[model samples]
Target: MKLNSAQLGKHLQGKLAAVYAVSGDDPLLCQEAADTIRSSARSQGFSERQVFHCDASFDWSLLYEAGASLSLFAEQRLIELRIPGGKPGDKGSSALIDYLARPAEDTLLLISLPKLDGSAQKTKWAKALIDNADAVFVQIWPVETAQLPHWISQRLAQTGLSASQDAVELIADRVEGNLLAAAQEIEKIKLLADGTPIDADYVLACVADSARFDVFGLIEACLNGDAVHALRMLDGLRGEGVEPLFLCAMLARELRLLSGLALQISQGTTPDRAFAAARPPVWDKRKPPLHKALQRHSAGRFNHFLLELQQVDAQVKGQAAGDPWSSLARLCLQLAGQRLLLEA
Candidate 1:
């Protein structure tokens, strides 16, 4: 069965499905949808949970193993498989199809992916999930710019506070359609304003610029080869208290993809063929900018990015010298085809 994000909460109030596939670009809503499922399951005696983050090297057999293993701690289990890359290659597709053929009893398998494009929706694994009688597919869409104020107003009501009309408009304008930032700002105002109704002045005092410079934006800047913009975004992200390890992890995902593409090219595969043959099959829209990035770095350079991420991880864990943020800046600069001469 298929449902929108709005229908998920009500649906969960009834019987829980054996499997769920949640896909969307709205991170906050997607996360909340997954959380709602877990919470509902927990209340009904699901005390055990396991999570898997799927990448190119992920072993699909684990899905079968996890399903077969009985959890001793609880009567039910919540198994979440997150595919940030979205495309579950041949093995993943087959595993999902086979597993969905007979979903385990007393286990809720939640598979989360980025928003599915037309072609992705037609894949065999996607069909297995969506076409199943016992599965629920929830598609979360982003809050459009025009709907921002109403969305903020709804969130405020849920947070046990109301906001003046001007205050809602000011926040909607400042956040520029970034739901995560808007959510954070609303939570902040809840603390500062207490039970008092929020106003335009209160919002202005409490929120920052609200133009989110998240890891995704930083990656786009690097891919587009805008070194200066990338640096500015890096600075903004760090100043906003984004963790160095989080940034490195995201950057590393991109670098690993690039490395695979570069390696294929070095083996005489045409860029077009390399992208098409890519494990997660590079979507057509991303191929252009990725092609640009591929030209800026070779297989060896992309391998070096893996090494740099290792160092950044160590720095974050306090197991190494030098600042992690500095290392991240250097990596970003190099990815954007610029070498930093001074301290990053």
Candidate 2:
């Protein structure tokens, strides 16, 4: 069974599953989902915990050992398997399928991974974890801009703090596409809330200008086909220590959006109608640059960029030979309609 973060809470109220798989494009939500499972496991007498980090050199048998081993201190335990790359390879795949096939009694297996693309979800190991009757998959997606304010409001309420619409809106603006920062801002404000409903003035006084050169801005620059601005923003983001994987991830999101809209436009759908039909329904203010973006690239080219991003991912992970930053700059330029004749 698959559930979102919202649904996971209510699901946890019932008996916990034998295996749980959680993945998302957003690290914050993924972490929260895993944490929730951990908490639920603990409350249900899973007092012992073991964590395994899967890497290129990881031994697959250790996972099997972890699953079958008897707990030393507690009768029930939680075993966590974290696959940052979201690939379990041949041996690990077999191990996962075998372990999940006969998951240990009195143990809860929690597998956390990076967001699995559609193709990844079809893999043997992935299907074993997901399609198994004893397993629950929690897939977390990023909060879109149009929904960020309400998300912020809900988050604020959790901290025993209330905020005016303008206040939450301001926080949303400062932390657009960055939920970690939004959560931090909310925590920071909790210390200062002091029994008063937050207003924009309070937010302005408490919040710092920390969102300079965020990925969303870089995306907007690319969508507008402003090569110079996009490159500069890329440089700024790199200078600010943003991971190339993160930059690539956000850029890939826009490319997906562009690819979908481009296909629609190519099939006789108006850009306006395509935007309206978008999964999240593009906001009016964000549609203009996307409209411009649609004019510059064909749907095929957008897909090509996404394919190249896979190489970028490999490079970032040191599995490929080249600088991902260089690749990203090339993508930025090309995304902005500036096709380069040579690789820099």
Tell me the tens digit of each residue's lDDT in model 2 across 277-324: 999999766988998888888999999999999999999999999999
C-alpha positional error of residue 275 in candidate 2 after TM-score superposition, expressed in Å: 21
Question: What's the distance in Å from true for residue 297, model 2?
Answer: 6.5
- Which residue pairs collide, candidate 2? none
190-269, model 1: which lDDT tens digit per residue? 88886666899888888888776878878988998988778888999988899887887888889899999999999999
Q: lDDT value for candidate 1?
A: 0.89
Question: Where does candidate 1 clash, by residue pair?
Answer: none
Question: TM-score, each model?
Answer: 0.65, 0.70
TM-score of 2: 0.70
